[model samples]
Target: MPSQGKLYVVGIGPGCEEMLTLRARKVLESSDYVIGHRTYLNFVRHLVRGSIVESGMGREVERVKMAVELASGGHVVSLVSGGDPSVYGLASLVAELVYRNGLELDYEIVPGISALNSASPLFGSAISGDHAVISLSDLLTPWQVIERRLRKALEGDFVIAIYNPSSRRRAGNLRRAMEIVIEYRGDCFVGVAKNVCREGEQVLVMRASEVAESGVVDMHTLLIIPSTESIVDGNWIITPRGYSRKYELEVE
Candidate 1:
C-alpha cells in the first residue's frame, strides 16, 4: 500500500470560474486527484490535472470514501464543493469519515463565497442585521426541524437566507415558509437571486408578500429575507449600519 497523503477540501464558490479563489485554483492545479459531483467537476475541469472522480447525485458518501481511499494511497487529493465548504458542503462528512475510519491524514478547508453572500447584494441590505441560513431540502434533517428553525428566525426578527428552497418533488416548501414568516412580519423585504455568478444570473427584489406570486424562483435560486430595518437603495440593495464604520474612525 502506498503511503497516505494529505486531503484538501476546496470550495469553488458559486458556479462562476472567476469566483474561484486564487488558493482554490492553485490547489486544484497541484492536486494528484480531484473528486466532486458531476456539475461541480465540470465547473473546475479546466483547472484539474491527474485522475478525476465524478460522483453523481445521492452518492456523496461514496465520493468521500473514494477521495479518502485515493489520499490514503499517497495521492494529494482535492475534493471540490460549491459555495463555502462549511455551509452545507462536504467538509463535515469527510471529517467524520476520517475519524470513523481511524485514518491519519492531514486536511484543510478552503473557504469560498456562499449563496447567501452571492445573493445578498441583489436585495438591499437584507442581511445587514443578524440572520440565519436554512436549507429546505430535508434530506438529512426532518421537516419539523426546518419548520422550528423558520419559526425562530421569524420570531427573532432575523434576516434569513434560504437555500434549496424548492425542487421538483419538494415544490411547496418555500410558499409554506413565506406563510409562516408573514404571520410574524406582516410585510417584509424579499429578494431572489437565480444562477448567481453564472451566465444567466437574474436578481429580483420585491416584498415578501409578492414572492409567492412572482413565480420566478427555483431550487437554483437563493432567497434573502431582509430584517425590518432593511431598505432598498436604488439598484444596490444593502443593510445599513455596518460594522466597518463602527471600527474605523475618521482622523482629524
Candidate 2:
C-alpha cells in the first residue's frame, strides 16, 4: 500500500500575505493540492501552483473530504481557512471526519493570525484584559444558547469579540445583540472592525445604542464590545484590566 500523504490545515490570516505565517506559506508551497471556500482560496490564489479545489460556502464537508481523498492517495494537500484554522474553522471538521471515517491520514493544523488578532490592534488597549470570544451566527448553534453566553459575558464584565455577527440572512442579529448588551452595560462602548488588513478595511467605534445608526457592520465585521469601564481616550478605545492606582501621582 502507498503511504498516506500529509494534509495541512492552514490559516491564511487576516487576508494579508505578510500576516501569513511562515509555516502556512511553506505548507501551501509544498502541497500538491489546495482547497477551501472560493473567497478564502482567492487569498492565496496567486501563491498556489498546485491543483485548485475551490468551492462555495456551505460545502465544507465536500471540500474537506476531497482534501482527505487526495492526501490518502499519497499526495500532499493543503486545506485552507481564512483565520486561525483551529478557531471556528475547518480544523474541527477535519478532526471529526478523521475519527468518524477512520481516515488513514497524516495531518497538522497550522495556526494563523486570527481575525480577532487582525482587528484587535485597531482597538488599541481594548484587548489588554480578559475577554470572551463568541460567534453570533446561528447556523450551527442555537440563538437561545448564544443569548445565554452573551449574558454571561456581560455579567462577568468580559470584553466581548463577536464573530459572524451578521449577514444578509441574519441582518438583525447584531442589532439584537446590541440590545441585550445595553440592558446590562447601560451605555455600551463598541468597536466594529470590518475587513481588517483587507481592501476597504474599516474600523468604526460607537455606543451600543447607536449600532443601527452606524451603518457599518456586516457579515465580515468583528465587534469588540468593551466592558462597562472601557472608554474612548482620544482616538483609542481602552478597557481597563483591573490595574491598581499605584502609578498615580500623590497629592499633598
The model with the greatest TM-score is: 2
What are the per-residue Cα lDDT tens digits for candidate 1 across 56-147?
98788898888888887788999999898999998899889878878787888888888987778656455765789999888888999999
**Tens digit of lDDT per residue, candidate 2, span 53-119?**
8788998889998988888889999999989988789999999999998876899999999888878
Name the regions of candidate 2 deviating beyond 4 angstroms.
Answer: 242-244, 248-252
Worst 10 residues of 1 by lDDT: 228-237
- Compared with the true structure, all predictions reach lDDT values of 0.83, 0.86
| lDDT measured at residue 110 in model 2 versus the true structure, 0 to 100 | 95
Report the lDDT of model 1 for residue 123. 64
Top-lDDT structure, candidate number = 2
| Model 2 accuracy (lDDT, Cα) | 0.86
Q: What is the TM-score of each candidate against the true structure?
A: 0.89, 0.93
Candidate 2: residue 246 lDDT (0-100): 52
Question: Can you tell me which runs of candidate 1 are displaced by over 4 Å?
Answer: 1-4, 233-236, 242-252
User: Tell me, what's the RMSD of every candidate?
Assistant: 3.1, 2.4
